[model samples]
Target: MAQQERAIRTRRTILEAAGAVFDEYGYASTTISMVLERADVTKGALYFHFSSKESLAQAVLDEQVPFGAVPEQPCKLQEIIDMTFVVAQRLLTDSLLRGSVRLTVDQATPPGVDHSGPFRQWAERLIALMEQARSQGELLPTVQPRDTVELLVGGFAGIQLMSRALTDRADLAHRVSVLWSHILPSLAVPGLLLGLDSKADRGLRVLSAVPVS
Candidate 1:
């Protein structure tokens, strides 16, 4: 048990170090030596945990995926949107997560390794959440769950990319709100618009407070 605990801690240290380095100097410029130097772990320990840098990179990517206990009961569409925004905020605030997001966006178009699993898994979870919302009559009858999932994921990805470029210039919340306001209304039932609108307003307010950069 002690051995396992130490291994886990070592792995976490490596991930944290890698994330910081990646954030400081993008994937192309980052090096294994830098990761080791940042982590302060012996080369043997790193090699023991991960066979190669790509594997370590994959580990870093895996660590960033949002996977926590969600509400047991069905969540309102607005609630889900708020939760998603909160997760985004966390990612934006976390240096490691921020670096991971940058790396993911950079590698999304041109795959170098097998780090896509986390993304696909994230998309799948969103799709499942949408389906749940649909079953609860939270979505409009006209809204296609799959399409909504695609839009939400795709739009979020686009915003993440934009956030990376405009890290110091753009407010993530405002950008998210603008995109959400435009896309959300169309995805909800007529009577549900009021709730969503309120949520969007709140989301906008919350996002406005998030510092750019």
Candidate 2:
């Protein structure tokens, strides 16, 4: 058991080190030697977990999803809003997520590495919530769940990029809140709009509300 645990820790350390390097150097310029130096792990150890640099980068890219017990809300729209805020809040400090995001947007990756997974995954998650909102009569009659989700996901990608450039994403939560304010009116029913929480600190509140595991 102890050996297994240690192996897991070693794997996490290597992945994080790779992520940090990828974040700094991007895919094309990031080499296995760079990751080894950052991780301070032997080549044998890295090869045991990841066969190649592409695989390591893909692992980091796949780690983009946020993990936690975010309390589910009765209003699916609110739940969706909270989800965005949570990501925005975490992006401020989480190096793994930051690295994943950088890889997702970087255009220099080799042809085999796909960065579209995160976007598709986010779109699918949001579409599921939007569908639930529609069933609950929370969404506007004209709002199509898939369409709204696509627009939102694309808009969010752009918003985060702008925020990253402007303030290193320090203002991302606020920008996302502003985005929801403009988008919710068009997406949600009137009654739901008034009750939804789109505040900037909502991400912090949502995360804090989760009991420590």
Candidate 3:
């Protein structure tokens, strides 16, 4: 058990190192040597966990959908808003998340480097939130959860991409707040919509509430 736990720790260290390198250089420019140097582990140690850079890239991509610090809300739509803001906040500070977002959208990956899992996970969460909002009478009758979720996912991708390019994502939370404020009125019932927390710091407050380990 001790050995297994140590292995898990070692693997996490390596993944974080590799993610940092990926974020710095992107996939095509990233090399195993860079990750090895950053990880401070022998090549054999890296190979025991990840055989190649592509495998590491996949692992990093899989790490993107971490839903940290989102306490359940009376309004399900609030939960979704919280999720977006938290992710934006994370994108700014978390190397793994920043790496994963870039890797998932980057088209120059080696052939068959699939990032469908993260995208599907995002869709599932948004769809579930939309469904919950419907149950709580937060959504308009004309708002189809699946369709709205799909549009939201697409719009979020574009907004983050533009933000990353323009501001290195410094304005991500603000952009996301603007996005929710503009779209919520159309999709949500007026009563619930007015009560939603669409501010940029919505997720930051949730994050700040958790004690740092």
Candidate 4:
């Protein structure tokens, strides 16, 4: 058990080191040596975990998902808003996530890399929630889930990028809240809008309740 746990730790260390390097120097310029130095591990150890820089970057992108928390809201639309804010909050503190976003938007992404996977996954999740919201009468009759997926996913990417540049993501939760505040009233049913909680602090409260995993 101890040996398995140590292997997990080693892999995590290598990923973080690679992320910090990629976050600093970008994917193209980041070298294995840089990661090795940051990780303070031998070449064989890193090779055992990640074979090449492309794989490391892909792993970083993969790290973008699979960890988050939000309270169960009566409205799926509200849950969507909560989901975005909590992730924005995480981007402020988690290097793995921050690095993933940077890698996703970095102009020099590698050929054949699966950078689209995360976006697709997010779009699919949003589509599912919007479909649920529609079933629950949270959305207007005309608000199609497919269209909502496009708007919410694209809007979120823009909001997060702008926040990262302008305020170093310090205002991400607030900006995300502002985004929902503008978009929700138009898409949500009047009855649902009144009950939806899109406050900037919603992320903080939810994080406090469930905490990030």
Candidate 5:
């Protein structure tokens, strides 16, 4: 059991090191030696966990899906909003997530690595919530779940990139709040909008409430 736990910790260290390197230098410039130096792990240890740089990049992208996820809300729309904000908050400090987003949007990624996985995972998750919101009458009658999901995903991607570039994401939460304010009016019902909380500090509140693990 102790050996397994140590192995798990080692893998996490390598991933985080890789994430930081990738976030700093991007996929094309990041090399195994760089990751090894950052991780302070033997070549054999890294190869045991990840066969190649492409595989490591893919793992970093894949691992992002589970980080900083908010607890489900009573209103699916609110849940969706919380989901976005929590990620926004985490991005202020989490290099793994930043690395994942950078890789997903980086046009220079190696052809062998499919960076679409995180986008699809987020789309599918949001689509399910949007469909539920529609059923619960939280969405506008004209709002199509798939289309709305696509817009939300794409809009968040753009907003996050802009925030990263402009302020290194110092104001990402505010930008995300602005995004929801504009988008919700078009997609949500009037009554639902009144009940929704799209404040800039919503992410802080949500993170504060989450139990430390």
Candidate 6:
């Protein structure tokens, strides 16, 4: 148990060091030696945990991606939206994660790496929630769940990029709130707006290792 605990601590140290180095130097310019130095670990120790730099980068992504705290509940539209914003805020506020986002966006189409797993998982979950909401009549009759999911995810990603570029000084929370408020009225079923208006009654909930920005 003690050995396992030590291993866990070492792995976490490596990841945190990698994130810091990547954030400071950008991914393309960062090297394993730099990570080793930052982590204060021997080459063998780093290799024991991560086979390669690519694997280390993947580990960083796995560590940073935020997951919902509400679990897979009844899939109410408002619930999903609330969860998304919570996760978004968590991601946006995290400097490390914002750096990760920058790396992902910059290296999304790297030569042999499939970087779409996280994005696809995010879209899939949102699509599932939207589909459930559509079935429950929470969305407009004309709203297509798949298309709306695409739009929402795409728009959210775009906004996040903009927010990062602007260094989060533009009141991202307020802007996101306003954007959702305007968009929800169009996407939601006629009487569902009231429920959405009450979304603030529930606080932001998220699951991730990084601190909220």
Expressed as tens digits, the lDDT of each residue in 34-61 for candidate 1 is: 9999999999999999897777777777
The candidate with the higher TM-score, 2 or 5, is 5
**What TM-score does model 3 achieve against the real structure?**
0.94
lDDT of candidate 4?
Answer: 0.82
The residue-by-residue lDDT of candidate 4 on 1-213, one tens digit each, is: 998998899999988888788877887888999999999999999889888888888998998765445677778888888888888877877778777878877878878677777788788877888898889888888887887778887888888888877988888888888888889878998876778788888877778888434
- For each candidate, C-alpha RMSD in Å? 4.6, 1.4, 1.5, 1.6, 0.9, 3.8
lDDT of each residue in 67-139, candidate 2, tens digit only: 4226899998899888889888888877788888889999898877888888898888888888998999998
Candidate 1 TM-score, C-alpha based? 0.82
Candidate 4: stretches off by over 4 Å: 211-213
In the predicted model 3, the residue pairs found to clash are: none
TM-score of each: 0.82, 0.95, 0.94, 0.93, 0.97, 0.80
Error of 6 at 56 (Å): 1.3
**Candidate with the greatest TM-score versus the true structure:** 5
Q: Residue 49's C-alpha lDDT in candidate 3?
A: 96
lDDT of each: 0.70, 0.87, 0.85, 0.82, 0.91, 0.68
* Predicted candidate 5 versus true structure: per-residue lDDT over 1-213, tens digit per residue: 999999999999999999999999998899999999999999999999999999999999998778747887889999999989999999988878888888999888888888988889999988998999899999889998898888988999999999999999999999999999899999988887899999999999999988887
Q: Which segments of model 3 are wrong by more than 4 Å?
A: 211-213
> Tens-digit lDDT track for model 3 on 1-213?
999998899898898887788878888999999999998999999999997888899998878877434777888888888888888888887887888888888777787567666788889978988898898788889999998888888888899999989999999899999999889988988777677888888877978875675
The ten-residue window of minimal lDDT in model 2 covers: 62-71
Ranking of predictions according to TM-score? 5, 2, 3, 4, 1, 6
**Where does candidate 6 have its weakest 10-residue lDDT segment?**
198-207
lDDT of 2: 0.87
